[model samples]
Target: MNANHMNDIRKYLKYSILNNCNFVGHERERNQIFDLIQRTIRCGESNSALLIGPRGSGKTTLVNDVLTGFHKNKSFVSDAILVKLHGLIHTDDRLALKSATSQMNLDNAVDGKVFGSFAENLAFLLACLRTGEKHTSKSVVIILEEFDLFCAHHNQTLLYNLFDISQSAQAPICILGITCRLDVIELLEKRVKSRFSHRQFFLFPCEEDSKESPLDHTIKRIECYLSLPENSRLKINGAVRKQWNTILKALLEDKKFRSTIQRLVDVDLNERTLRNILVCFFDQL
Candidate 1:
């Protein structure tokens, strides 16, 4: 390659690493999330959605990515609240309720007279928001990840309460509930089950050989490794580079090889493992 061309490629690689917001695949899911956000905001009404997926399946990341994109868009100005309830340490039900409600500092208080029913608390909070009164603004979209905990430990009181309150809300508020467990819906009360069913969109995992190829993911991971400022080059000889390409080609073409590489590298693998794989692939090539 010419000197200028090589330099340009290097510069593009560096910029890609720095920005790091490029989503290589998952176009369908990404588009679905984006469409949901846009429609909900434009309607200026209350909506709730359940995002279902297994752990490490990019459930939370997908939400964050969409929100990040929304924030970057010049025309999209909306109050998007993302809250995660994982390992919330609460001594009792009161403490748990307090911890849950306190995350937003919603100006509304749970009606003390109603004895803090999930329904009452949500009703009070929505009543206090005066949502549309804030001028021509996109209302709030609250994304709650790891929602199964509430279902597992508490009854469906809170879930149903939120559903009922959302119906009467003056300000447009939507709940984007994300959970890994498939049976999370079963835990909800029958009333909630019906309500959530009406509005929810289910997302399944991306298959290994689907448009989102595992080999491409591996290459992207390798690129990330190469871009790190570790002050230690991979020391890839000409043979090694050729070998790396061969292995990558094979991995892309063969699902078995990709699975083997995944088991070897693991999710929390380091640069050394990556280098070792490149060396081995080179020898094989």
Candidate 2:
């Protein structure tokens, strides 16, 4: 392969492997979230949900996919205000509450002035949402990333208030908390937990082995990547692409390659590790 071919191969591998593969698991969870958002956006229903998964397991990806589709509908964009809060950025309830005013463009409601106490500010926002005024009555959708960190705050007030609102009939709010912590529920205070709807979606990366051949999805991802369309932007020579794909097929039947893949699957072939493995494959080329 020449320099151009090698570069194209690298780019194609990284893009296809890292970002292109659709979520091969969690079909139910994805659909549930999509429906939850649709109800909140269209019906003004209040809901609270938690998406629990280990880091890099695509909890964020799942939410983004659902939201991106909904964003195309004018009702979704106009009827709801989306506020994203990360535990790392808004370390406390006060910061979160302050940031939310800005996120909802209600800063103008405060006229850029330093607002009242954080609790007061939260109360004010809640009042605005329930005020029955056309502009202020938009539904609120709050997504908390790294949700466990927010639980570490002194009183867990942000979670409490959001949960309280989620159960309300007057103001429609949808709250989704994404976290890696399995015991996240235990971290919540009893009062806060009481208000939560207890709607939890759990996602775990697929275990790729039953002590068998490289699992179907495992090989399928490689097949999809290798069998790029003739007119793909990668511009890889068709004959060379066919040759590489042929090699992949032959390797699937080869004992040594199958054994190697099984060992990798035993240890979990996550996306990050898969990228490194591709780099190692490049070194051989």
Query: lDDT per model, in order?
Result: 0.58, 0.77
Per-residue lDDT for 1-285 in model 2, tens only? 567776787677667655653454567788998888778877878999899988867788778878877788888877788999999999988788779988988776766556555556676776665545653467888899999999999888788878876776557788999999999999999999999999999887763433324355566545655555666677777887777667778876788876787787788876456656775776576
List the candidate 1 regions with Cα displacement exceeding 4 Å: 1-23, 73-84, 87-103, 107-117, 131-138, 168-170, 198-209, 224-285
Across residues 147-221, which tens digit of lDDT does each residue of candidate 1 receive?
A: 776665455565666566466554566777888777777777777776663455555544554665454565666
State the number of backbone clashes in model 1. 2
Q: How well does model 1 score by local distance difference test?
A: 0.58
Clashing pairs in 2: none
Model 1 C-alpha RMSD to native: 8.4
The model with the greatest lDDT is 2
Off by over 4 Å in 2: 1-6, 12-21, 112-117, 126-136, 207-214, 221-258, 279-285
User: Which candidate gets the maximum TM-score versus the true structure?
Assistant: 2
- The local lDDT score (0 to 100) that residue 87 gets in candidate 2 is 98
